[model samples]
Target: MNFLIADSFTSALARLTGQEQKQTKTAAFDLQLNPAQPGLQMHRLTNSRDPNFWSVRVNQDIRIIVHKTEASFMLAYVDHHDKAYSWADRRRIEAHPRTGAIQIVEVHERIEDTGPLFANLTVEPDAAPAQPASPPIFADLSEDALLDIGTPSDWISDILTWSEERYFQMSDRLPAEVAEALLEYAATGRLRSPELVPANPLEHPDTLRRVQTVATEDELRMALDFPWDKWSVFLHPSQREVVDADFSGPARVTGTAGTGKTIVALHRAARAVREDADARVLLTSFSRPLANALRAKLAILLADDPAKLGRVSIASFEDAASELFQLMTGRRPTFAPDDALQAAVERAIADLGYTDLAPRFVMAEWRQIVDAWNLVDLTSYAGVPRIGRRNRLGSKQREALWPVFEAMRAALAARGLVTRAQLFASVEAEFKAREEKPFTHVIVDEAQDLGVAELGMIGALASGPNALFFAGDLGQRIFQLPFSWLALGVDVRGRSSSLRINYRTSRQIREAADQLLPQKVRDVDGVEDDRTGAQSVFEGPPPTIIECADKADETRKVADYLRSAVEAGISPAEIGVFARSNDYLSRSRAAVAAAGLEGRQLTERAEDFGNCVSIGTMHLAKGLEFKAVVVMACDDEALPLQSRVDEATDEDELKEVFETERHLFYVACTRARDRLHISGVQPVSDFVADMALK
Candidate 1:
């Protein structure tokens, strides 16, 4: 008989202690090896609604809930003896009638009525009697419309009169697709149509998501790991469609923070490797840490087949490009630092007699137009379309500016050092000259942060119709100015999808962090993030915004908060302190020190801090998570950093500065899972004021 492990079992298993978990795994392995062994005691649960439900003895107190039939034995749930029996008693394994998908649903009769809507109310004898409560908002929807979406038959009448609170309490009892649709309808007054009926119930896409047939120990281990990462084992119907889709050209998946954009990208990479025998997949992200996380998750997903895992590669975008550059040039490229490049521009301008123009403006032109598009000569630089450059330049201005850019290019050539953009340009040229590209498919996570030249290099590496796929959130873009992807030959205009379910953050944190942005955020390519439709899976305490009289006062308050959190059972490693720039990290460390705890500075390679609190800039905090986060030193001029604002040469550059700063704050605040603390001096940055935290 086949052995299967359900997500419900893992959810229950995660609660057991180390010893208890180990005993439970031993019981599970035995069951998988031989279900009918006489040494194992299995008793049919008389109180369960489903006849197949049985309880297997794990120890004196712990029990495992198993659903057994002639064909298979499925591990459904596990807990202490009483709780395990109660769980099986309330739930039944069955195939949905209309959608024909297998689901473990709660028995309707087992649920208790939520007594009265309001408690402790008194009615006067003289007052008129209250009318019966009105029907639910969806009462007008036809039964056919409701059933089409997979709503259970027995619960339909209750749903017609159920309040929103009652619905939330019983939502897990319904099929996932139906519950998601009903929640959306309650939040926004619009109902969506249901999916078409599938040809087979057991083989339906939605059914395959929750019900997996495990025939070996490897599959059981995969199921056990699902509670911590449900997205990898169980894909939502919407997310599965995106992963399995066959796109004609480059495609993108966009959503707000916590939505499973990264999940889709990782699964897509795996799917390509599994389906195509000759496919070479490259899974990359914006930073080394995130790419490392991706690699770890990939191992869990593909553990059953090590051969397929060998076919996939994981790396940061820059690392991958640098490796490919070395392969082509036979020498490592020494990139010119930002300051050195700017100095080259200054020296070139002073020597070429264009000292009248602001050095800032000349540098901006070089970055946005000259370097970004790989303009090699004055002729190419003269006609390059400055996509987001607000200042208009006529022929006289172009003629005058070309010489400064050309001079800077010449200076870099003389030093034998190349800029990052120039390096990507060289890599792209090499890819075009080769008969075979390094990767057959390139899946990019955090694609929104890629610069123009990087996108061009990616396009050159995998330019087939189904060669490239990108996943990122537009609101989380902390680096690289906004540029048109279409102009660089990677257009995802018609083939983009947005994920709306947030699995990482709490509702309070998500809402408060959203206040820092407008209702809608759109990239230069006209793709918009559907922020309104996004919702968190859980709720937490609203953030506390602390305003102090001075820096010392703020630091003291922050230290007290940290100590209190630790006293309340949060470990030091679970807490993170961040600032707008490295300039304010000293204050962050001081707060940690005052709290009587050491702070570990988070770096690109250092992720685990053991028992020390992590301190870093907002940029470094990207792709990391914590139980709580403290955004320190939001002083009047620190966040927007007076120097950056003072150096803006035009309206476009200044606008980009503010946008990136706001995104930085949002990213830092959302990294928190439960509590978020935003502290600043009395005259705080304007963004803190916008948070309106209570």
Candidate 2:
């Protein structure tokens, strides 16, 4: 008989107490080894809707529910003895007739409460005049069309009676494919036909995600050790194409927040290494902390095979460039401090007799244009398109500025120091001079944050037909300015795709955060990415937004939120608290302290956060998620980052400060999987206000 594990088992297992979970896993492992073991004390369930349902003793009170057939033994659910039996009584495993996918359908006939199921939604009858009732969401769909999306046979009447808002409240009861399909059709006016039935019903696309055939002890062990059912190995149907497709040239996958871009990147890297035994893959991102998280998840994804993990190297873009530079030159690259660079710029301006240029303009021009592009001579500086600069420079000004930049570069070199731009340039040059590439594949996460010099090095590192792939959301482009990837020789024009189904965040949280960005975001290369018609698989309560009178009140409110989240069963380690910057971290820290829970500050190098509520700046919250999140200190000046706006020399620079700042807040807000709380001093940030008004 084939032994299988259902997603429901893992989800139920996660909620058990530690001691109970330990005992349950032991029982499960033994059952997998020998389902007929006499010591398991298996019993046939008398009340179950599915005759195959049976109970295996986990402990005196806890029970492991299993479904047994002549050819298959599947772990189905687990809980206290009575609750476990109750769950089995209300559910039955069967292949969906239309989609040919296996689903555990709820036995609604056994449910006693039909009043809640048919509750009518209402408007405020006391204050406002009576409004016309909106039409039911699925009233127009024929029964055949309803069955085509995998809706259970008995739930057709319940669905057709649901209005738009009412459907959202009860959508989770339907099968995932049904809810997703109906949601997509309602939101975008696009309907997908039912999947074709495969010969092996288990091979159906939906079955592949919901149910798995465990062929070995190791696979079951890994499955049990994973965090939750949501993190199952199966990719969403949309992500499967991007992960498996072969790109003729450089490729990219873009999406909004929580759309599983990083997951696709990791799978693509693993796929490359698996397809070729000699492949050397480097999975990378823009920051150290995010890279560490990726490495940990990659280890779990590839834990079944040590050799596959050995073929992949993980690093941040900075670390990768630095390692290459040191390897080629036999010495570590030394970087000039920002203060020293500023001093050099000051001296250069004085020496070049240019007194009119503002320091902001001079610095931005040198960093974004000269150093970033490796402009070595006056001609290159003269021809560079300063795309984002609002203040255009004349020929005379360009000539005058080039000499100052030259003097500053010479001064930095005299001190045996280099800028990040210089280090990557040297690495790029070394990569070009070599006949053999360092890695066969380069997969970049958070690719939107990559800088010019980093891209230059990456362009050289990933030159093969399938060598380069980028994964990121344009809305999450917080670090880098927009640039032309085609001009840099990494063209994704024909090979780009955007993911629309979000797996990480809740529908409520996603919609709130989406308000902070434009509906359509275009890149400098004229690649337009639409944020429209995005959908989340699950629903959550609307984010809690509040305004406080003072720092003390803000701290109290945030502390209350933390306690409430904990009381609601969200563990401390699964919670995160963030502020705009380190300057405001003390307030969040105090709130965590007041809540009587440990708080670990996330630094650039933080990896193991232990069992503490994570506290950090919003910037460090990238690529990290939690069950609950608290974003505080959103006082007007703290959020748009007053210092940046104050430093902006032109309208363009000022606009950039707001855009990126909003993106930063959006990133922090969407990091919560289920719950989010935003509190600030009186006069909250404009971004917070946008969430409510928009």
Candidate 3:
């Protein structure tokens, strides 16, 4: 007899029943018939909690208890455990009548349950029912009797509550050991001492001891009286709030570049580990550099404490997922999207009936089909009408087309036709399976560059309410793709708190940068232009609008800027020149070399530099801040505005691209902490004239 593989269940079900069911109902797929194999164990899953819902293993000795009812099958409600059923357990089982005919079997001895396994064991009839309808064991006990019970000293309930409230703004429900310890402390009016508390609270301790005392008005003054020290760095109110709040939901912190987002995130992790002890906290970043930066920062912050270091895991998101995927699947995942497979899908769509649609349009059309296969609501596409004819596809047509597209996508995805979206989804599923609980609070930096699919993946990591924090600048988006946080499902239209005070740049520099994009400037809180009695040394002949003859002249002018800036007080490393195209960077690098001035072109594989002139394309400069920046070589084709174009193409698309470029330029200008130099040839990008001295 052949053993059934869990991977092939969906296709097998579709073949057997002649009906294509969605894979979202995984519980249903697990419960259906077992491909008619003889001598199979048919291990009926018994309820450790609810006895009515049962599951059986095919050709294996695994068992699971059904919890939820699906269209084709039941969902596993409880893991297999040795605990006997109680009164509450029986009611849950009796609530849902078992629908399909499944074989039932009884096993007396409990198997050696090892690893992080969930089981539902069968209870003997003679031995009590899996769950009994008995009164509470302590129901008859009087308040006096409860009070008289011997309790341990060192009750840290108040401390636990205080600590949780400080950071997460919530309370932690005490476990049995902690509750008992708290009870004893309450009766004794004194803690048993910090040493008596369990070493591992995340695994064993039910309560936490809040040792950090809140500073009163007088105490705060007294603390502030001391001379500045390293501890002074840890005393900011914002940092205090992060350290105190008991994060129960996602939180987003939007601040300027130096406003301490990373610092707050690092402190939050440390606080979580020090306070909870038993809980595991993961600090992850999108890039390896950021992750390594965070790890190094955290190491310095958490130095001299061995226990605190053990509880925190710092890694990049890709690294974490890649490791887990390798461990569980026995292979590393190749995350490249299958363009050839997508092409095949496009061809299939055209051959099947879609005549006028391109491959990308066909892919969009098939989105509905994929949604149906995933068991998502078909009505989600109510406003999006079907392709072909103005009659508009009805709900019925959507339902009809869903299975075909979903099947195709799934088959392609399995064969590696996965997109970034599919890759994120798989990683989320893997993370959920591996992690016991969602993070308390997740803080993300550079969130403005995140795509919609990436945002969805971030949402998945935050399990409880209020667990997300994001900080980003819309003006800094340089990606060819839109970084519309709103499009990624973030609401930015509402009245959100803003940080406006520019502290990093001088008022003269800020004023000059603002002049470069007059219309886009908006008021921000705390931003002030405080340049009293000081001349603007940074101010120059209003951005040199040089008229270069061709690309060769453009490169020569850029090389000139690099040499001039270096001759001044600015170090070679302090100066960065940006362009709109990579070809320009390549050509500019050669020109700089010919000019006999040291220059390096930035690339993904480039290493860090201490003091070398840097050249890069605009897109590579997002999320980076520099001391001084030189933007060069803007022209008609590179920075076209709507008024320059004569064709009747999509005006909305043009406007969107224009606005993004404007913001990108704004971001580039703002990167300069002290000085900004911009130069472009004649017929300069229309944006330059729009805000320049006319």
- TM-scores of all predicted structures: 0.86, 0.94, 0.52
Q: Rate the local accuracy (lDDT) of all candidates.
A: 0.82, 0.87, 0.45
TM-score of the candidate numbered 1?
A: 0.86
Question: How many backbone clashes does every candidate have?
Answer: 0, 0, 37
Ten-residue stretch with the least lDDT total in model 1: 225-234
How many clashing pairs in candidate 1? 0
| Residue-level lDDT tens digits of model 3 in 1-694 | 2111211122223222112122223323333333223332233435344333434332122233332233213322222222212211332321101111111112212245574554455645676446534332233333333322211112122233332113111111222222333333333443333222334321111111111111233322222222112112232333345445553444444444333455667776777667675656667666565566666566655654766876666665566556545765788777535565576566566556756545553454543223211333445545432222223557776665554465556666666545544555565666556455455545565555554445655666655533555555544444323423443334433323233323344434455545434333231222222221211212233344455777677767766766676666566666677777765566556645654667777664435675576778776554345566777767765664344243213344445467667766665665566556666666678766654543
Top model number, lDDT = 2
Error of 3 at 603 (Å): 3.6
lDDT of 1: 0.82
Which structure is stronger by lDDT: 1 or 2?
2
- Superposed by TM-score, candidate 1 places the C-alpha of residue 498 at a distance from the truth, in angstroms, of 2.7
The predictions' CA RMSDs to the true structure, in order, are 4.1, 3.2, 29.6
Which parts of model 3 have CA positions greater than 4 angstroms off?
A: 1-248, 255-281, 284-330, 363-408, 429-435, 438-440, 464-466, 478-497, 508-547, 640-654, 690-694
The digit string of per-residue lDDT tens for model 2 on 255-364 reads 99888899899899889877899999989999998888888788887876879999998999889988888888889999999999899989988887778866777888
